[model samples]
Target: MNKTICSVPAKIMRNVVLLLTLLFLTGCWDRQELTEMGIVTGIALDMNKETGEYILTSQFLRPASQSTVAPTPNEPFILISATGKTIPELMQKTNRNVDRNGFYPHNKVIIMSEEVAKSGVLHLFENFQREQNIRSYAWLAVAKGTSARSLLEKHKTSISSIPASFLNNLFMDANADAVSSNLLNFYKKALKKGESPVIAVLSIDEGVEMTPQTTKLSGGAVFDGDRLAGFLNERETMAYNWVKTKIRNETLGSYDFLSEDGSIVALALIDKNAKINPNVSKGSLDSFSIEVNLLTELSEHQPMKEFNENADIIHYLDNIEKQAEKKMKADIRHLTETAQKELESDILGFGDRLYKRYPSVWNKVKDNWRAHFKDLEIEVEVNVKIKNSGLIKGTLLPESM
Candidate 1:
């Protein structure tokens, strides 16, 4: 019994010694300090037309003390551009201008110039996916009528001391409103065989002295396979958002309840869901049916009026439904037409749907999926339900009435 107790104590001492040794040996293997790294806020990619080389632009956040403060102090974001045959080469060139190592873990946005996007982006995007430091959930976008370097130069506004934090917050606000796609969503779309990738487009318009810098979320850029085929405007993007079940809270245009001239009543969407059903016919793809349900509440009313179950009120609701439906359908049609006729790419995951529905048949048609998508038909249906009308029963009725 004494021997047994002595052996147990020896085992405990051995275990404790082993744990202490491990603790002592285990130091930060991959730890980096902010001072040792250049925090990349944004990246821009463009193809040089003259040399047929790739231009990679990166916005590195400079410490406040390093920036010029007087004579119209430029923002803390520094724009560096380098040209190379590949992205890695360009990145090496970017590192030459910076004191610290360029790190992308804090990268908020990746802006692909229209030229690079149109030339083909799969290779560049693939590199991003493979990188260990880059975040998979960073926001991706395309710039309009501007080089990636130019876009980075225009990001002079910083809401906080940390420019990277401010830029990230801006994208978060846009994502919540369904105006942009986050990195994870972009990756899924890019990897899906049947669906073409879509990215948010950022358009910057330089302003005069008084006018503030105009940063507009232009639309969605539709990619066919690995190349950009077309773009959607803001309205069309809204429709695309509806199709993707991305919208959180948005005002679905206004309706006149009592009178056409009365204050327009608008419904704010609280929740939404979208589903796509693909139907096959005669061994060929027939059509895709998209069903969208929106739960909304009355957010704003023009003239306060008492709640009534009158015919006019019912008619107003019907009209609102029709108008919203029409707009939504038009948006879907625009995307479909752009994907089929213009881009000749199946930006909508119709190919994946086909594969899931009929795998054996999909194998036969996968090679010519774009051709099949062109011949496909698409239908959209929107169902919106109004739940509550805020604090007021209705808009305030005119005293004269």
Candidate 2:
């Protein structure tokens, strides 16, 4: 018995040591060395309409000189482009221009030109989706009125060394009017039955004199089954964003209200609560009612009148709120009509909402939701409340004036 117990301990020790030796001898066969990799910061896909070929542009991080201990920021990137029939072919061509292997984990954004977007984007993204190295969180945008390569080459970056990073950061800004979407989120919505993807629109703003050319994110590109269907202007984009999301720190826009002379009020949205209710009766859809309640703070106003009395200030503020509500309602109405009548696309998630609430109803119209969407009746209600008028109760004009 004693001998058997001793052998068991010895066998356990031998197994443990053998496992340790195997682990120590193992090598990382798939490990990638930094020196052999070229970090890709951005990618732009454009198409030659006449030639029927794709032009892929890749922005790579230019390595800092090894001689400098701490190198200052310089031209931090270089653009390499290639043309081919397929994305894989373009990538292979791009690889010949650089010494190191292309690495995509650090990639910030992927931009597609209007032409490419209009044609279709699913085939282009297939390679990216299959490649395990490419990140799904990379942002996607559509360049409007310019080629994707031109925007990548020209757009000036102030905060980030990589222009792609700069473009990605633009979506985080609360004041941005465009809709924000990443690769994974885009794919999810693109493949969804009732919903569609809305990608942010990037454009170069030409500067006339003292101003330099800058990048602007003002509108959104609407998609229907991977093909670009239409676009939403800045105002319509803002309204759509407000309807889809809860607003915090977003400025809805300036409103003009007549309160004892012409007064222009700029309201900053503090909080928003939005609800989309689909009306259904006897297994048939009726209409969708969108109710939006907003709490805002007065940011600026052209002081056309003085409000010294409490009653006068109260009356003036009430009128401002009413006018603001009216304007917001009209904006929402216009946006809905544009989506239904002009675009014939369901950029809004009305069908998705209906699906989640009443799956049976969605099942009946799933195949022909597009036709239903174009004729769908949507009602919008907006309520605005100005919580505060900043430090001063009335106009900042001096009493002497």
Candidate 3:
């Protein structure tokens, strides 16, 4: 036998290796170029009660065409919607109307109709995670008083070649300031037990038209498991963000700073952190304590009060801290009470905390934990640090010596 001779040809082996390397290195097998693909910016999910079907609406960035070169009387982007039993089914229906395949990798937002959210969003989201290639960081929101399809169809703004980019930027800003939860955070909270998930809610205000955009984030939606449990106003949403330790550089309204003058002052939250400590007593849950630490800088001052490091400043800060503490406590109390009584679902991830702190206990109590949660006592403590007083040491009011 010729031991030095190879059974297979070296040239064939080399070609195989080259082909394998190319296959692994470049994933261009199904890749499509920008010109060949349609970019989906936003998606809307609505439920049809009559037929128990889902209406999926998508906004696609329309490519430049000869007819659209000059200017169009209509919007730049095109809206397409389809109804089916499932998302994939809807996709098939959608493909019939559009020339290019709907690509979702760059999709910015997922809007759920209130009815759809109330009916159940878990299945829709499961599909999104399993079948769709949308980024985990995209924004998730609820559309108010209308079907998701309506929100998608009403487009009043125009962007240069990319209208969705503008909407994406708006959501990014909102999420950064703790105004809303991004998709990643929403999914994380939603999946966890003993905690409820929340998403920013978009609505169209007939009274005000800030932009040509048809939809705006008015408040936020609270979810118990996969169902829409309740809605939070903008202020409550801000407070919820603070409790979740997600606030950054957002203005928090001041309380009683004007000393009976009834003026309002606002401070920008520079940094904030919140910790939830759960304690078990007598083989049952005793209480959960939430400690919130906030560092803020003065953004707006009213009645021109002075803020020195002296007794006056200390007193003012003390009052401000008290106000903040009161507001935070109220917000937490409302959330807890509502989650326990009205929703009967945990959206706050208390179960995760329990599981982490006392896994053995949680294992025993996990089944009927909702009943126990309602009786669980909760304490909230807020510590606010006024890092900066802005340009002046205090306000310019004549009341201050």
Model number with the top lDDT: 2
Model 1 pairs whose backbones collide? 196-347, 303-395, 303-396, 304-394, 304-395, 304-396, 304-397, 305-395
Error of 1 at 330 (Å): 3.5
As a whole number from 0 to 100, the lDDT of residue 217 in candidate 2 is 80
Give lDDT tens digits, candidate 2, residues 1-401: 99998999899999999999998898799889998888998999999888989999998887782226776466778899999988789888999998877888888889999999989988889888887556888888899998999766746545776677778778676353677778898898888887788888888898779888888887889998799988999888878877885443446544444444565677877677888889999999999999989888877777646667778877877888888888889989998999888887777788899999999999999899989998888888999898997635455677788
Regarding lDDT, does 1 or 2 come out ahead? 2
Cα deviation in Å at residue 258, candidate 2? 7.9
Task: Give the alpha carbon lDDT tens digit for every residue of 1-401 in model 3.
Answer: 55446745776799899998877776666778877687888888888889878888888875453254575555557888899877778887887889988888888878888888888877777767897678888888888887776665644552434445655655655742224567778777777676778787877655555644355665668887778888877665666677764543354433223334475666677677888888887666678888878777666655657556577777776676567566656776786777677767665667789889888878888888878887778887878777776545645656545
lDDT assessment of candidate 3: 0.71
What would you estimate as the lDDT of candidate 2? 0.82
**For this target, which candidate reaches the highest TM-score against the unseen true structure?**
2
In order of appearance, the predictions have TM-scores of 0.79, 0.91, 0.82
What shift in Å separates residue 94 of candidate 1 from its native position after superposition? 1.9
For candidate 1, write residues 1-401 as lDDT tens digits: 99998999899999999998998787698888877988888887888889989888788876764556543355566777888988778888999988877998778888788888888776776677777566877887888877666656644554465434555565666642235666677667777678877777777667889877755565688877567778877666666666664544354333223334445666666677888887777775668888888777766656545756566566665665666566556667886787678877775677887788888768888887767778887887878777764543354656577
Score residue 25 of candidate 2 by CA lDDT.
93
The better candidate by TM-score, 1 or 3, is: 3
The candidates, ranked best first by lDDT, are 2, 3, 1
